[model samples]
Target: MAMRASMHLVKSRTLLACAKEESEYRVRHPENSSPNARVLVLGGTGRVGGSTAIALSNLRPDLRIIVAGRNREKGASMVATLGGNSQFAEVDIENVKSLEAALKDVDLVVHAAGPFQQAERCTVLEAAIQTKTAYVDVCDDTTYSWRAKSFKDRAVAANIPAITTGGIYPGVSNVMAAELVRASRSESNGEPERLRFYYYTAGTGGAGPTILATSFLLLGEDVAAYNKGEMIKLKPYSGMLNIDFGKGIGKRDVYLLNLPEVRSVHEVLGIPTVSARFGTAPFFWNWGMEAMTSLLPAEFLRDRSKVQELVQLFDPVVRAVDRIAGERVSMRVDLECSDGRNAVGIFSHRRLSVCVGNATAAFALAVLEGSTQPGVWFPEEPEGIAIEAREVLLKRAAQGTINFVMNRPPWMVESDPKELGLGIYV
Candidate 1:
């Protein structure tokens, strides 16, 4: 009887899973689809995607961006908003056929979709491989970005670039640390030391379904870290710290998240210790997420419906604040050695989307300009890439919109042969 029951449960789950998959497919792909040669913005109808379109468009008008999404009208409207060089198309990530059709002929794919926390069986990286387009996704979900390594070899085999977490914490923060450590090594007999990265997305603006989805994905993965060469499962909101956001943003409280780039960076650089912490704007907001995580166990973290409800509740409020508060995303990365040596860098910007979008633009532009060494790379790898990326970011930040700043601790502020300087790259 027990065996029969187990079999029935499996069959029931399989059917339900199939049904959900079918539903996602229908939503992702709906009829008309044509890809462009220059660029493809997967979730162009959404906030980050639209901003990315604007940024890229401003940078280079000759490059065409196919604004893609399920809603043709919305995509077309966004494209129209960008003028003649931009065009709109219908394509979906959930639907594999649609994704293939959407990616056809596109040189690059920027996936800006969301709620990847519920994703189990399907992935955008798979589609990128099948489509043979260089891939970049603004996925803030740490674990999903980490798990994406499964497709790395395939990406290499296809001779296409697949980069994830192209957003604030993982994207810019990762590069920041990479640049610092690389510089330290360059100065100090070629041996890199440990690094710590802190990202605080303050002012509580621009929170969306995608961000919530990222949260859920991290929750499901139970966020992990490499400490003393052992993998330790981290509870959400467990690591808490008060970080100085610098100047106007002031001191903000942040929580330790299972941001995978920390560990991934360590792996890439062979650095022994690397950890990251994240927090939001306002003390109340920081405490609120912590409070929620404490009350809800991992089981509740896996509840999709709950995640959706939170998205609905937070999305509008966050967007409104993003527009009004001029809320900024700030990151501070510190590098240290065993003998009380440290260097710190800070990047602050008014918009999270612009911050990340610009970071992607910088790296992508570098790749286009042949500014980077060829081969698989994290933004921070290849020694000098992070330094180059930071210089680009800081230069653009000075022009306004995206603000990237670097600072060293007071003791290490002065120029010294013993310590690394700005580590700026051309």
Candidate 2:
């Protein structure tokens, strides 16, 4: 259902509020656009998709971008906004023929259009499979991500490379944890062990509804974590955590939740233990848990009238809230070796777009550059994939350097175990 106009106006102001609190953009590296690699971004007119397109255009001038979406005008507008070497085509994601036609001769496909809850029954994934084309998506939907994983066996057989979870929370969060595992294993003389992953968002406003939807779908679902070398459930919100987000985000409370990364971090990376949590600016973070806890049980959350009513009410209020505060998103991953040694790493980014866009674009660039395989892969560990992958993303998000921490906390030069574990839970 279309959002009420009042809701839209409120959303707009809320976004403005988020922008004000966003950190300054770090200086970007010049695009390494190679003329040989061409990319087709489905849903390129949307938020994550659009940001991914812009980041890619800016990062790789040699890349020719073909944008396909339902609306030609909007697609063309996005293309125009992107400047040279970009074009748009109207295609229905639901139609197999339309999708196949768009996929013909495309080097890589970035599926950015979603709320895949509705789109999954369509032809997007199947078209990529049939075309034998590489695919990537900024999908935040957990069910879709799991279902996409089912494509791994077939994709490998077809020699088609595909990647999902190409957005901030799952995309970078997955890779960042993978990198920590790889780094820790290497440091520990080749032995990998337990893993813990933390995810937090402070200035992330545009994605509030998306995050809320994700939480609802996973609620009451058994969240799996490794226990003593065995898989186990960690009830969502069962483990309250207090995570220190450094100066930009400050100290905030988080909850133990069954999250997407738990699946990949353990199954793909072979880490014995893996957990993920949500982090936001203090108030937004707290409000999310409370609001989701309340709204998820009823059909009202899906009700257009109720959604708009709340959006209209919260939108204006969110603006005033932003003026009083700021925004941020940070992630931390720690690896524990069976031998008792440990290594910790943290990545923090201010703008939601940069954090996810840089990661998605870099993965696309890797495919274009032939640094990644044609088969499906989760960035479980940095060692197996292109060595250039992390560097490419880190370089693009150069304006905001991703902080890497070891034994010390990024927010504090020293460590306090209680501060780290206490605040985020309750």
TM-score, prediction 1: 0.79
Instruction: Report the lDDT tens digits of candidate 2 across residue range 1-426.
Output: 242332222112221122311211111222222244568898787667777888888777656788888888888899999888899988788778889998876767898876554234525766888877777877765566778777777876666667777666667667667666666667666566666767676534444444344444445355566654577655555465676655455456666666667777788778765666665554554667556655565455434445556555566555566445444567766666777666666667666655566667866765544444545666554322454456555455444644644444233522223322432211
Best by lDDT: 2
Candidate 1, 28-141: lDDT as tens digits: 331111112367887788867777777777765656788888898788789788899888888867788888887766666777776555557335678767766666666665
What candidate 2 gets wrong by more than 4 Å, as runs, is 1-34, 117-122, 189-191, 207-212, 215-222, 282-285, 298-327, 381-384, 387-389, 397-399, 402-426
Question: Please, what is the TM-score per model?
Answer: 0.79, 0.78
How many clashes would you count in candidate 1? 1
lDDT of 1: 0.61
